[model samples]
Target: MYGAFWRILPGPWWIRLLIVLVIVAIVLYSLVTWVFPWVQELTNATDVTVGG
Candidate 1:
């Protein structure tokens, strides 16, 4: 979260910024690596079972 970055940002702005960027990059990579494949499979699946 940006809130985490803010706490770490008081010192050298570049390094904190790099950390934040890395975190965001990792999160985005995770979503692409995990969530996206699941979503594609679920949406593409023909035998989906939904309940209310």
Candidate 2:
């Protein structure tokens, strides 16, 4: 399983931390791009403005 894989792979903490960060960033990006629009639709916006 994944737990075993994590235990078997030997590396520094920063390398593991970097991998976790990259995975998290990828998942977050996927959620924001593909799933966030539905979330936005569910909420009501009272005020909004774009200066640019």
Candidate 3:
């Protein structure tokens, strides 16, 4: 699967690397900005105590 993606990207190696990095950054930012907070709300993850 990864090899197919790498083959499909339309660029030289460095350009492909840059594009992949940008894609990863966008995904990470989206997850952190929206997805994580939504899941946290659903799970109530902040109100936790380890060992009182």
TM-score of each: 0.63, 0.53, 0.85
What is the clash tally of candidate 2? 0
Q: Which model is ahead, 2 or 3, in terms of TM-score?
A: 3
Candidate achieving the largest TM-score: 3
Per-model C-alpha RMSD: 5.2, 6.9, 1.8
**Prediction-by-prediction clash tally:** 0, 0, 0
User: What's the candidate order when arranged by decreasing TM-score?
Assistant: 3, 1, 2
Model 1 spans with C-alpha error above 4 angstroms: 1-5, 8-10, 45-52
lDDT of 2 by residue, 5-36 (tens): 56665588677777778888999999999788
Pairs that collide in candidate 2 are none
Q: For model 3, name the residue pairs that clash.
A: none
Give one digit per residue, the lDDT tens place, for model 1 in 1-52.
Answer: 8687588575677888887798899999999999999998878676668964
Model 3 alpha-carbon drift over 4 Å, by segment: 46-52
Error of 1 at 8 (Å): 4.2
For model 1 the TM-score comes to 0.63
User: How many Å off is the CA of 17 in candidate 1?
Assistant: 0.2
Q: What's the CA error at residue 20 for candidate 2, in Å?
A: 0.4
